[model samples]
Target: MGKPVACLAVAIMILFLYYVIDVISHASGNRYKEGDPIPLYANKVAPFHNPSETYPYFDLPFCSPAHVEEKKEALGVVLNGDLLVVAPLKLDFLVDREPESICRKRLTKEEVARFRKAVLKDYFFTMYYDELPIWGFLGKFDAEGIDDSIVTSVYLFKHIHFEILYNKDRIIDVIIQGDLQNALLDVTDNKEVEVDFSYSVKWIQTDIPYEKRLEKYSQSSSLLHNMEAHWFSIINSCVTVLLLTGFLATILMRVLKNDFVNFTHDEEAVDEQEVSGWKNIHGDVFRYPRCKSLLAAAIGTGTQLFTLSIFIFMLALVGVFYQYNRGSLITALVLIYAFTSGIAGYSSASFYHMLEGKNWARNLIFTGSLFSAPLFLTFFFLNTVALAYNSTAALPSGTVVVIFLIWTLLTTPVLVLGGIAGKNSRPEFQAPCRTTNHPRQIPQLPWYRTTLPQMAMAGFFPFSAIYVELYYIFASVWDHKIYNIYSILFIVFIILLIVTAFITVALTYFQLAAEDHEWWWRSFLCGGSTGLFIYGYCWYYYGATSDMSGFLQTTFFFGYMACICYGLFLMLGAVGFRAALIFVRHIYRSIKCE
Candidate 1:
């Protein structure tokens, strides 16, 4: 039974590997690959004769200088080029009877009402560049709740359209913000419809000359020849080096050698040695030292990983990936990840106080170091390079100083109080009852010995963004299509949640196998390893895109993302693993004793 279960697990793992390899391999042939050209619209552009005329082919209006319709305000300012301010200060789309007339022929009255009905019912579809969607459905079905009043509301309504902001010089990610009233009819007098949406960034693809061959293999309908390939070179990836991993005897032997030993070895039931590695401050974590250290570590790592996962998904969902500029997002993600550390600190402090960690100063210092110290060199090197190149935002020195200040002044106190509250709280961890009949030390279940199943589960959450973004990016790159997948970042929220759950489950199983009943740290570590793959992929991307120069390439590649994601993922992995570990331990401890 043990052998067969192991075999099944091996088979499953192989299939998963194949799936990932296929994605990356075919990724180059993506629908909208960097260098690919955009396809021409079926109907070429003709000069618009009438100001209010409707075109025959496309639905939108012709490009116009200025013609305000009746629509309510939705978003912020719209910039013309890379510049920050170029505005009506607050400019958006003003909804009219039908969209602005670009084509010579006008839409039939029915079509005119249809446009208003669509807007009133479905609202608008937003597009952003680096976005993380945490809520709302992808705009698929027509929206609901449209009454005649909505369209007729005050005779004019408008929604602000702006690319969620992205400074090639500054690593920025915009979250999805959508809120518009549903149910509107009457399009006779363009009324002002109120909108309630939020901010972020947006994206667009330029068309390059089209080749018939491209159409044969492409999924994207739009193709232009004036394309730029980012990081997607064939020579740079270690992707081809992978071998069929059906687990040879030696492979199993190696795994067993390491894990089996760890499993069988008996550990001291109680932690006897001094709890000295990372000290909690003023007993900030809890009153006790060792327990506080463990909890703090757990919190810091878990929160960090969870947040990182959210961002990755958000970007992927939007089909926005620049291979030549891989590192740019990394750096920004790192800074964003700082927030996770703060949350972790707070969680740790709360758990520590519950466990009774004694030293307050130790809690703060150790928790801070658990995060800052480990990755300091990597971030420092990145920042130094960024400043040297005169590329991207240097995260104002004031920001760094401010961060530390916040940690000590604001974070520390919040954590301490939360810790105290935790001390007075009750355990919420609950585990499924152990129900093995005639329980065997060596069970023969296919999934019994390995944590692969759990790890696979974690993949789905992260993959959700990948699922949406991958299809779009693939279409745009390899196929040459256009999709509004990146409008909002919140779309990734649910996927992130799914991923966190998977990590927690897998970590629990790994800990159980290790028999390190003090399985918290390892649990977190196991789940946190996914971030390593992210960095690996980014590095691979950097070497792939050929058009970028060494300097522009480097700046574009690692400028915004590389530094940020690396730091962020590290912290993210730590937090995710910790969360899973602690949750498992809590549940494990509560199981009915034999």
Candidate 2:
């Protein structure tokens, strides 16, 4: 295909995927409700330590002496600290109804089944598998008798129970299960008073254990969910190990390289040295032939996804798409993330290109979609598996098509357009102002030799800004914490992108000051170092934990390592890109005698 057509094809592929996801969600009528049966987060737990009472201390009305006398029974001493971020929630369709449960204005049987399937499919399955799960309701269960329960062509289920987990003013998890055949089963319950969903009631988490297998015993069948989940499990495991090692190894290697020899060239300064803008500083910042920068873009794209995932999770915490309601929100967050890939690719490639870049195609392809594509495929495959196996909550086909369309028509085009704009927007190079026509002696400082360490350290402060939020995000995803924050997480994501690049530039500058004339490799290293710190901190956090057990837990820990590894690589690319841009500006400026 020609360039335009090729671009169109790429856009179509991306849009097709995105459109599918979105369409599936929207076509489902947004049935999943807020909240689910998931556990309350630690921040909430910190306030509920009162032994005799179940309610948190902050709930005291302070209206009467009875309230004042009970004030001593409160759960916590208020204080200020870093506010954490948490994951976004889908819906919870689990559990039978409880007395005093909120009444539904119009509860239908189909809604119940879909919601139940969603609960099992979304929370239990998604909570377990980052990509997709095998046993989720969509992947495994299918209620064949729901079609008979229709009244106005709307197939409502017979039985429905909405389960919710809460902490005072904040509702944590929610589950809504409705039995259709059963609702139609007894003509008695339906012939009566039309009850509403506003049924006033507080729900509680029971010790009723979650069944290990998705479907109940009696009829043996294919374990599609298990098989599918296992496959991804393997993939996730490998990625985790490699990711962990990648960051850790890179950090150690860079440190060693710095200690041993200078990766930067020692082209002795010549009198009247009329060198290309970046020729004076030989480093990764200048330009990588092809695979190098492309590889960098791929890695950076993954890291950007990882960061964005965390951002989605944070939004989950503050209750945007709590549990059952998560599909729409997750879709939205991902759309935004995909659209932003332009920055990662364009930013990286633009600067490197300016430094006299060779191949632009590789750079754009990797940066634009490499990172999101993998996970996107994972999710799509999971949904496909779910559909094939006739899982209840599997995404609808129309939604899938729509999601795919958006990726093509909306995200891809917009990102590319934005990249074009960014490409046209050049950085003012001022190196000519400082470049001397007469040759000068090059300073050699072993410590200041590589941009790797400097750029890596530059990622520190930005990393710090996000560390706490990330912790909460990971906790929510793996630990089954009730998450519902999105807006804050979205903002944080924007901040992270800017921060990562800014810190990278700062570090690149500092290394230049240290007398390291190399910009090519050091720029990449300086920015990529954040991954090392992030992964290291992740491991440290794991070690500090008191509870660590079972294959799932171990797998989660390992998979996180993979995420970190990929994430580090992605960051490295981005940082390099940013640093390269700056370096090119310097060279160009110097050439122009700016």
Predicted model with the maximum TM-score: 2
Q: Pick the candidate with the highest lDDT.
A: 2
Predicted candidate 1 versus true structure: per-residue lDDT over 147-260, tens digit per residue: 433222311122222332223222122233223243122344344322222222233222322222223222333422222221122111112111211223245347435543
RMSD of model 1 against the true structure: 22.1
| Backbone clashes in model 1 | 147
Lowest summed lDDT across 10 adjacent residues in model 2 is found at: 73-82
List TM-scores for all candidates, in order: 0.38, 0.43
Per-residue lDDT tens digits of candidate 2, residues 1-594? 124334533654564455446544533332223444432111111111111111221221111122222111111111111111121222233333343322234435443443333322222211221111112111123233577332222222323333454333233344444432324222112232232322122366444322212122211222222445534543454444346435654664475345223323343443335443233443333323345655546544644555456544544454344333324454545465655555454454554455455566566666666655655665565455444543322345555676678777776775565445435555433233344343334465566344444644566755665665565566554443433345545655555555566555545455544444445455555556667777767676666742454333344355545555555656555545555555556533433222
Candidate 1 residue 450 Cα shift, in angstroms, is 9.8
Off by over 4 Å in 1: 1-295, 304-342, 354-356, 372-380, 390-493, 503-507, 510-518, 545-592
Each candidate: what lDDT?
0.37, 0.43
